[model samples]
Target: MTNVFEAQWEASQVEAMEALRAWAVAFAELNQQMSSWLDLPTTDANALGQVLWADSSGDPLSPARLGQRIGMTSGSVTVLVDRLEAAGLLARSREHSDRRRVTLRPTPAARERARAFLEESSAEIAAAVQGSSAAELATSTAFIRKMAAAASGATTRLRAARS
Candidate 1:
């Protein structure tokens, strides 16, 4: 009893979901490759990536903030930070107004390694999307952000339900 418009909308939704799933798979593969190239486990690489992103955004992460972002315990974060620091991939400094707070930053070597590994792929991705109209690209960006928000909200709800 569905109308033609409803059917078409449903088809579009299905296609969007499939594309999102494919994107997730591709992202995981990229993470795996990066991890291997860095000679670090996936979790460590992910934490490093978070630190790099936060630093690049001009808000470097404290250990506690990094733990919250990565869903790790404070003790676990300490261990991870120690490991990364020992490997010379990360550095911790008390640069905040409150000297007690330690900020995490990726070392130059880590940044160079990541840039070397990702520059080509990043450029290719930009090239692939360059043909899209500005409006189309904006719409796609908004759609991805909406999808991410929905997924994150669902995760929060599920965690709350468990608690």
Candidate 2:
């Protein structure tokens, strides 16, 4: 049911996706190394990144939400939060009228440190894409987003099956 051109195109697409996956793995390892440089565990670094992302999106994270994002248990997240708080990386604040609700916010020091640590890599990445047109960038962004959504969906399905 497939022509040669179609088959070749599909094969090339698969190869491209595999290359992207490899890049993702390398990026994750780089993140782990960065976390080590900051004396934080990989999970802690992931949590902090998630918190920062949420804040940048104008929706701060609560401990429960942070745990959900990171696939951590509430108890584990609480301990992790405590450690980060002790290290002056984050703060837990009662921002809501509901006194029981607590928000996790990255400290200014943490933001500055993360920015400093990432500046070099960020510059390199930006430079790598410096010649891309807006349409190309948009297409790449959409493709990556689609891949992320597909991966997330697969994870959810796997978790449901396990449960």
Candidate 3:
């Protein structure tokens, strides 16, 4: 039996979580459209994004690593890698100490195209936030970060449960 104020707070929390979920789905749809701009499906688009992120982070990319990042299976990753390689978007090598560990990279042209597309989207986002107060932006950023952490924890728990 919760008090009235506690119940109200819980309700508000639920509403905020729902809004977060909706925002995530909308963002994914936008990303899908961006992928279409590259003439690639959502899976490949996500995989490409992960590869680019790894590269930007100065971390090496590989098919196995990408599959883990994108919630894809080993076979699916292999085929996805094959298709991207065939499309001239992905470059593969074996420079790692472990000869069996294949490294992945995005082609310069593909990376450039993705960068251009995202720049346009980011400019739109910047414009959308133009009138927002600094405090508002900080609050929004904090909320998003908190929600992201919770969601990531949920994913790990669910994956472990499945295993």
Candidate 4:
């Protein structure tokens, strides 16, 4: 018979793997919706989405930082941002304090359109989750947080190593 600790460890591993799989599935579904909503090529949609979801401080994200979050390289980020800017979805700006630092921000139109799309998507997701039991919802919420934290930590380490 397995010891209690061993059983608990195995259960934890299973839970972690399951959570990862669920996150991948949810992300894929969301990606499909975003692709259709933005009417953009996959890469462009993803890059634009990252800009749209960024904080509202009106500060631009560095190309390197954007690339790290979007799973692309600095060069690719530059090209992607250029395309987005050309399409009027995003704009490039240099900080007044440090003109050497370039950053990207989405245009007002892009932000409005993305917000509508996300609101509809969120409503649909909420409706579906509402059917779940409270306990199930709680478990799912906890699982998502745990998995997101794990992914965020991994991405941080990867970016640090690259820098």
Each candidate's lDDT (Cα)? 0.90, 0.87, 0.86, 0.81
Q: Taking the tens digit of each residue's C-alpha lDDT, what string does model 1 give over 1-163?
A: 5665455467778899899999899988988888998899998998999999999999999999999888898999999999999999999999979999899999999999888888755776787699789999999999999998988897889889999
Per-residue CA lDDT of model 2 for 1-163, tens digit only, reads: 4664455467768887898989889889888877886778899988888888798788999999999888999999999999999999999999899999999999998888788777855776777689788898999899889988988998999999999
Counting clashing residue pairs in each candidate, in order, gives 0, 0, 0, 0
Model 4, global lDDT: 0.81
Candidate 4 residue spans exceeding 4 A from truth? 1-9, 57-60, 126-163
- Compute each candidate's TM-score over C-alphas: 0.87, 0.85, 0.78, 0.71
Best by TM-score: 1
Model 1, stretches more than 4 Å misplaced? 1-9
Q: Predict model 1's lDDT versus the native.
A: 0.90
Model 3, runs deviating above 4 Å: 1-11, 127-145
Expressed as tens digits, the lDDT of each residue in 1-163 for candidate 4 is: 5565455467778877876888689987788788899887778888787777674755457778788777887888888888888888898888568998877788997898788887888886778788799999898789778878988997888878999
From the highest TM-score down, the ranking of the candidates is 1, 2, 3, 4
Number of clashes in model 3? Answer: 0
lDDT of 3 by residue, 103-138 (tens): 999999778988988887777677768878999999
Q: Provide the clash count, candidate 1.
A: 0
Worst lDDT 10-window in candidate 4: 1-10
Clashing pairs in 4: none
